[model samples]
Target: MSTYPHFGTDAIHAGQDPDQWSSKAVVPPIVMSATYKQRIPGQPDLYEYSRSDNPTRGVFERCIAALEGAKHGIAAGSGLGATTLLCQLLKSGDHVIAMDDCYGGTYRFFTAIMSKYGVEFDFIDLTDISLMEKTIKPNTKMIWAESLTNPTLKYTDIEAVVKLSKQNKDCIVVVDNTFMTPYFLRPLELGATIVYHSVTKYLNGHSDVVMGAICTNDDELGSKLKYFANACGIVPSPFDCFLANRGMKTLHVRMREHQKNATAVAQFLETSPFVEKVIYPGLPSHPQHELMKKQAKGFSGMVTFYIKGNLQKFFDAVKVFTLAESLGGFESLVEHPWSMTHASIPKEKREAIGVLDTLIRVSVGLEETEDLVADLEQALKASQ
Candidate 1:
């Protein structure tokens, strides 16, 4: 019997046995063929069609499952694609309770697309445990939440949510673990039914590939998702799978740097005269800082703040931080949530959730802490 290794070792070695391949190469080879040769008329060896499965994608899937401490993993073309697969589990009239301050794309999908299909969704502030309990209905099928919400950095209590799921036997808890990744947080161990990620973010660590993944420990749920994945043909290409797997190998190191840099950036912003508020789970001032400590190993690279001066001037003055969309990349980026990420949400709804026009969300990268601090310092002064 083979012994299981540590998280870092599992990342680089799990699902990639050099001896399994004829080439004996250390890296998992990208199997790009659409179909594999069958041994018999209808008897396919391991993989028959690429849509159903690919060797490269299998390795990527297995590696992520191991990282997330899940028995199964399914890859999708994009993050929303993974969520779409989860929604497929619900039939007409199924109700979903989702965090009010969630990713804009997710909000759009739930309200615009899912509603048309007869799936009812309620957007609520999940931090209020009583509110969550009150919102549950007999038809409630899923609770969609983010560990640390985007732009605002609100922390969700995964254990509490899981407890609620246990009380409601019909409900399955699905957590979007993209921000924390498996390095900082593992939702399955905390009793979440499913954990998904946008591989375009930290899991890829580079902004190149767009993909998503679903991880679960339930055999039946995993099988159903796998069936839909193959039937619907939403799986990613072999090359994108290879890239994501390669990026994940260095996730441990990259996440550590991200945490360190973000800590420095958050502290700097808190003291800035041009900054009205700083939001980061790592900071003591954050409302859910204690909950974050209880749930995650470390806080991720995302930070958000409200500017006291002109937001445009601050955006224009920043030299190092690029103004862009998306988070969890190696290069530092800053974005206006009200305009960039949360634009899909209505202005009133956005403001109600504290996503104001003056809000700036920063993805602190692997840059030197002093340099990043200096850059922000200069930018704040210039804006004033």
Candidate 2:
């Protein structure tokens, strides 16, 4: 059997051995050189070029790989960079089935850029096993999904999707395990072909860095992904990797507090007369609450709801929470999906996916529970 330290120990110590550094530094030092000197003309050092690999980035990659319970981890320039690399695995005639209510950026990439290459995509609800069964074709090379979808917080049973993928052996299952994080859910453990993340979000736990990662146990797939990153020059800078490494060390602690604060906020919203509907996997009212409990450890800090009153007034009235774009930060954020995050999605499709104008997507931070509730309480009143 394989042996490894606990999650916290690995997060702090993986790929961080001081012996690897000439200076014997406790923390992994950033190697900013564009190219490493080689002993001979043809022979190269372990990391010949920064595009292929960097010291700091390696540390973060190893740390994330350990956390995700995977054999390989590849870091990219941004969340979309990781996504773009994954799509590179496809060809002109390949078909892909993706979650209908996925992030706006992901939807835009599939419909606009990937489709232009003659790769066909079908956006459908992955939660319904029969829908996935009916929509899947023999040419479907990839089944992309998110456990808790963006803006709406709908749940997809990732394991069930993986089971279905088994029927089509050539197809790969990719889960965007961003909202759940490794702390809450490791999709690879559930038999997913690959688990990916927009490292700018929960993996970093701070909004400072924009990076992306993909972890997999498949050796051949790992090699292909790494080649894509190097050939396309879609690698993250050493400094950004350094910042993300620092941010990730505190992930376990931050996630706990995030869950605490978010659970309280969701409960409050469910009781509010101003809120029309609340979507949080942790709550019993959520459609997939029991399944979520079966598939993962805990729900992180995301809550989505529909307002019964003035949306603009509520967004403007928030005192503690900031009106912002990105999530998984130390500070609370409230975003309107229809006008803000999901604006790139066509209006008709947005409506079809249940992303209404009154829908509110909040990234509940590690703020005190009472204070966050009080802020929302007033916002609801003003929205009326």
Candidate 3:
């Protein structure tokens, strides 16, 4: 139930309807005409090009498919072009499973570019539901899910992987909500069949747009995901869809100031001494913090940890964090996921999924929680 049932008025008036235009302008007019002016000359009406349609990318894909309650919304050109337009809904001998701490470019686009197009993937640990009931076979078809994973935030439960991929009623779960962002989860109201997004982190919370999106309620899989985003042109730039719809009109107050400066810098790095572990599902020393409060309504601003000092001396002593390698932005950024974003996963599959080497990953932004906990408490006392 979207199109404005709340989440800050569906992020400032879902699809900003200023009387549909002609300058009634309340804030939706970036329509950079890449082509659109046909009136019965071989019948073309509701838009006809700009890589297949654009009115400022249909008002940020109908305000991010009405902030994920969704009925359709598709944008791309990044977030691995919405995972290559959802791997064109798979086929070449299809089979997938994903989510072994996903997001290192979606595990190198499912093992190096969709395994050269014959599909086939596996990557386990989807909260180990008995190793996904011993890997559902018979041409699997898709499962993916990511929830709060990436750089070791680990969460995967998307309603128990949509109740075990409906025992393959032609399986399809696909959730990567891109670090919990329908402003804190809405994996298609928890039975997900589609809920992608990188939307350049935190729904464009200002890392200056990189875009990518998807959402669905399944009208023929939203008409084959808008015909694979206009047949793989990978749409997205109408000025980065008007700067990601003006950063989703302050996505619920920038996700409550990025979860209040990441729960005050992960409770000062779990009472530092240059901490050793502190994953953060809004902490209860998170071990799925009660299944992240029984399926998220909060806890984002990802906070991964493990650092008993010196990771390049806390990335050369942070001055209000920013060692960088992408993340939801307003500023604070940090990295070193076993040498930046799971260094193409092979150091024994990034330490068999924990991504060690002093793993850090922060992303928490919208700063000023005591200046990001006095710059991570003087960069963990200059990394001890």
Instruction: Please list all clashing residue pairs in model 2, or write none if there are none.
Output: none
Q: Residue 355 in model 2: shift from native, Å?
A: 0.4
Give the runs in model 1 whose Cα sits over 4 Å from its true position: 1-4
Which residue ranges in model 2 land beyond 4 Å of their true spot? 1-4
- RMSD per candidate (Å) reads 1.7, 1.4, 16.4
The global C-alpha lDDT for each of the candidates, from Candidate 1 onward, is 0.92, 0.92, 0.84
lDDT of 1 at 133: 92
TM-score of candidate 1 against the unseen true structure = 0.98
Candidate 2 scores a C-alpha RMSD against the true structure in Å of 1.4
Candidate 1 vs candidate 3: the lDDT winner is 1
For residues 135-209, could you state the per-residue lDDT of candidate 3 as single tens digits? 978789888878888878878778888887888888899888877788788888888889888888888878888
